[model samples]
Target: MSEASNPVVEGSLRERAARRLPSHTFSDLLVPVSSALDLAEGHAAGHAQRVTYIATSLGIALGLDAPTQLACNYAGLMHDIGVVPAGAGLGAYTRGDERMVFASLPLLSPEEAAVGASDSPEIVIERIVDHVIHGARTAREFGLPAETIKGISAHHEHWDGTGYPHGLKGEDIPILGRIICLADHIESMIDQAGPLLGRRNLPLWLNQLSGIEADPNLVSVLRDLASGDQFWLGLFSADLPGEISLGCSRLREPKGMRLLGFSESLSQLVDSRFSFTVGVSARVARYSEALGRAVSLPDLRLKQLRIAALLHDLGQVSVSERIMAKPGILSVEELEVLRNHPAYSRDVVAGIYGLEEVADWVAAHHERMDGRGYPDGRAGNEIPFEARILAVADAYVAMTSDRPHRPRADDADAQQRLRGAAGSQLDGDLVEIFLRQVVS
Candidate 1:
């Protein structure tokens, strides 16, 4: 579907997000999202956080202004945002496999090479480059600073002009991109090696690829920063997110609506992971808002509900595409893994400030009034009222939307299914309100 006609891209939700973005810090808003992105790529927690720390520190040490430093910080957090959509074309390669392929680009392990043996090198490079291209587009759509978008676009470009998508050489790469490139590599090293060993070897590693892989000037700045034991200690600290936020205190905060757009953009990215599920979150949010208004929920409560609806499936990123796209019933183990996503969603959202209540509602989206949910078995009013509304909206959208395993139910059939499940699999009143008011 054309983006302009897509319900998710409609302006009403963007207005709502705009209205809510001003009160929170940009870091507070994006750190949870960074964690979610990490989950999508199958990386351990804190990769983005560490990258943000390293890139921002390098920006500051290099005498960048506050705005540039903030861009560096955000670009670091969201550099790989394209990976979700890019994974769609990478056949049979798990997110972990994709990561390995990208990390060892222009070189592949025997197994990695075997997976794509039939594909030409140009095709593989194009697929790998797709992530950065989509990432830059997403960053722009979210109304990020121009420099931030450019940095994301060029983060993978090598100084020697061998990168994919575009191979601009030397100073052709944005400085912020150069800093992030170095930071991204350094963070990977730290993740592969323990912090102590990573720190010890960083100087040698930087010297070996100083001009080929990254900007030599940025490498020198990082080398100087690495000399201080305190830098490594701070980066590996348990409260790395907090430290990054504190360090960024002097930078300008993003306006409220931009942060909201960022959240909406992320929800779209999550939905893009599977073709059948495209726009599911947006539809759910639309229905949930309609239901919330019908119930006369307070404005603040409605806003919270909207945000939760957009992000309710944030944990779905943890599920493998193979399982999600399975044309038949999932095995019991696979089903269990699928069922655990809400808990993963909760853990990721709870890390964001002021979203604790939203996190709880998101976690309970699958709970039935009859206590049949997998993650939690709260029945009757035990489930949060907001979550009950979310459940009805989710059920309606899922039924009406096509899935790999089933055709889309017609409106009449979907309504009947909602009515049938009312009071058992779903809250009866919310279902009635949804069908009678919202659906009508």
Candidate 2:
């Protein structure tokens, strides 16, 4: 174990560690990330995947090439991504009613504006319009082609210039956008369907929407496609992610920094799940990875820590907006939902292949050394070392960030609180390394 004697052996070990690390592709991350988005609405499980299938199917029917079809699918999968950051006040966007449609008239209520500066209709609409724009930006950031970005951003644009953002009309709308907009509309209608109004009224609904919401030509195609049993069967199919993969020939497999970049983008989306937690995960990722490096963790473990930190708060998507945005202390009942977020994060990450170790770290990010933490309370060494690093990183970032409940802690105060919790709450040695080396 002598330092001089171990140099060669340690270098070899690091090389092996680097080689042994697994690279996650875009599909692996996108599937679960989209699943996280779907969890924001209790009734909307698999919503994105279903829409992808429908939209892509229409893309094929419309004679789009393979790349364009894949763009349609990508747009369908990511159409709601803007919901993460603006989740609190996006009820108007999700309703799919005429009243909620984008128009020039004042949409904000006096009461809604009183909630917070960010809750105003003007702000929410800006955010809602920005959803499509944000989706396009995210698609581009993830290395999706320009077609994908255009399709996703224009998915809300209408034929008569009644849509959002650019308000393109008729042929001015991108074909990919038109297809996804129709698919999105159909999906919403089906989601709202129930005992009173079943699938039988779907045609009537389409008929009602022909000239206003979309092009009459596109509506005719959808109407024709709706008559086929195969469309319905495909719409409700269980293997949506698989189906999308089969259609998307251009999705490159992301590795190394590219993979990490995707995780960072996803972290931003996860932060969007609640307005208060914006940028929280990205900061944790930076701090945790830095601390992991400072502690001389293996290359593979550092990568795991970075990914875990990026997605640590993913479970919060399942919690209600009211609970997430509550300015006061959480009710005992609300705390129950909030407490399950870590477990939810664990489960979401675990479902994706090659990230089992990262999932464990994400699940344990809230666990305390003294066993007073949430989801699971394993104390001390029972928690993984990387999880301990995440705990410290998460604590420091959360404390330093401004929240609705309280003002942000200044650097000096945040350090004192983090230092005070070294042994019983966080790993004492990691905290010291973080304090002395990383942040300092």
Highest TM-score: give the candidate number: 1
Q: What is the C-alpha RMSD of each candidate to the true structure, in Å?
A: 7.5, 6.5
Alpha carbon lDDT of residue 326, candidate 1?
79
Q: Write the per-residue lDDT of candidate 2 for residues 367-388, one digit (tens) a residue.
A: 8999998888889999988899
Candidates in order, TM-scores: namely: 0.88, 0.80
On residues 1-440, what C-alpha lDDT tens digit does candidate 1 reach at each position?
A: 98878888877777676546236666776777788777766677788898898998888788888888888888998888887887674545433344444444323322354355324445555567787898898888776789999999998888998765688789999888888888888888778888778878998889976898789988888888889988888788898887777766766565454445656787888898777888999999999999999999977788889889998998988777667787899999999989989998998888777789889999999998999885988888999999999999999999999988999999999999999999998989888888888988
Report lDDT (Cα) of residue 318, candidate 1.
76
Q: lDDT score, residue 7, model 2?
A: 87
The collision pairs in model 2 are 84-272, 84-273, 85-272
Candidate lDDT scores, in order, read 0.81, 0.74
- Among all candidates shown, the one with the greatest lDDT: 1
Which stretches of candidate 1 lie above 4 Å from their native place? 1-22, 92-122, 258-260
